[model samples]
Target: MRNIKLTIEYDGKRYLGWQRLGDYDKTIQGKIEKVIKLMTDENTEIIGSGRTDGGTHARGQVANFKTTSEMTLEDMLAFFNRYLPQDIVVKNVEEATERFHARYNATGKQYSYYVWNAEIPSAFERAYSFYYPQQLDLARMEEACEKLIGKHDFIGFSALKKSKKSTVRTIESISIEQEGSLLHFSFVGDGFLHKMVRIIVGTLLEIGAGSMDVSAIDEIFENKVREHAGETVPAQGLFLDEVYYR
Candidate 1:
């Protein structure tokens, strides 16, 4: 068997997220698997680097699957593009080592949240960005991000019912930047919990709007309480930008 790695980009507006849910009719992983089975005429299961919630887009999402097909990587990419839905595309495909596992081997990930800070609705970016009318204090939001750039118990930032193996994760960097009416919040981290990125973005939004003080960031770390954290922002604004290995 050989491992095949694929780089994917998707518009997540009409899907049920990345995982294969028994009840859900639409998902990125499910759609990919359907196409793979059709192309190879073999039962194949694709494993992704992470599960992105419904309506959350991805620019460089990585996935891997084991297959015994004789098709070349280029053929596989072409086959997927022809069979997959228009909104989801297989950007690249390459043969990988048999031991390669997309999720397990990833060393870090980068996520970006886009905010449309304009009063008028943006027709082109409406589906991809979060619309917020408040004037943001970019400096204060940047200051609050400094507290998130280290290893800490992120229980407060995750969903309440998540029973993950550990809540402690290291964030390599967190940055807030504004370009005209668009504000972007980016994060590089070793790993993340469910809703972690959205919660972080929500917290920063509060700080930007002058609703939360920068010092409150420390409380999120110290308290380790989910309720103490900021709201979980909409998934449409979050994008899994890239995944790193090594």
Candidate 2:
């Protein structure tokens, strides 16, 4: 068996997220698996680094699959791009070692959330950025970001009501930058629970908007209360920027 690794980019506007649901043809994984079967006549399961929620996009998503076919990497890339939908693109393909696994071997990931801060929206960015016309205090948001850095139990910021697995995760850094009318928030972390990034962003926005205090984060962490966190931001503005492996 040959282990193949793929670098992919996709606009997740129409898909039901990255994982393949039972008999669902609208998932990114399902679409790619179907094309792989057509090319190699083998049902291969592609393992993604992680799942991106529905309507979330990706710039450097990584996935791997094992196959018995002897097709060249260039040929496989060509075949996938030709058959997959226009919104999805296979950026690169390569052979991997036997023990390589996309999700388990990942060391860190970078995710980005974009917001259009202006009252007037951009025609081109309407699909890609969240439009929040309210004025935000960048200073307040920066303070909140400082509180979120480093390792902590992030269950308060996630959607998981209960899990036996560890909820402790490390966020290496959180940077906020504004370019013209766009506000960009970048998060580099070891791992994130479901809806964690979105919830964190929402909380920060609330703090910046003066609806929530900066100290509320500490309270949420101490009490592990989900309701204390802000609303889960829309999925359209989130992007899986990159996945890293050591």
Cα RMSD of all models vs. native, in order, equals 1.2, 0.7
lDDT (0-100) at residue 37 of candidate 1? Answer: 88
**Over all chains combined, what TM-score does candidate 2 have?**
0.98
Off by over 4 Å in 2: none
Model 2 Cα lDDT, one tens digit per residue, 71-115:
999999999999999999999999999999999999999999999
Question: Where is model 1 more than 4 Å wrong at Cα?
Answer: 162-164
**Residue 201 Cα positional deviation in candidate 2, in Å, after optimal superposition:** 0.5
Every model's TM-score:
0.96, 0.98
lDDT of each: 0.90, 0.95
lDDT of 1 by residue, 1-246 (tens): 889999999999899899989735599999998888888888888999999999999999999998889998888989999989899999999999989999999999999999899878688878888898888888888888888889998889898566648889999998877788888888999999999999988888888899889998899889788787778889999999999999
Please report how far candidate 1 places residue 128 from its true position, in Å: 0.7
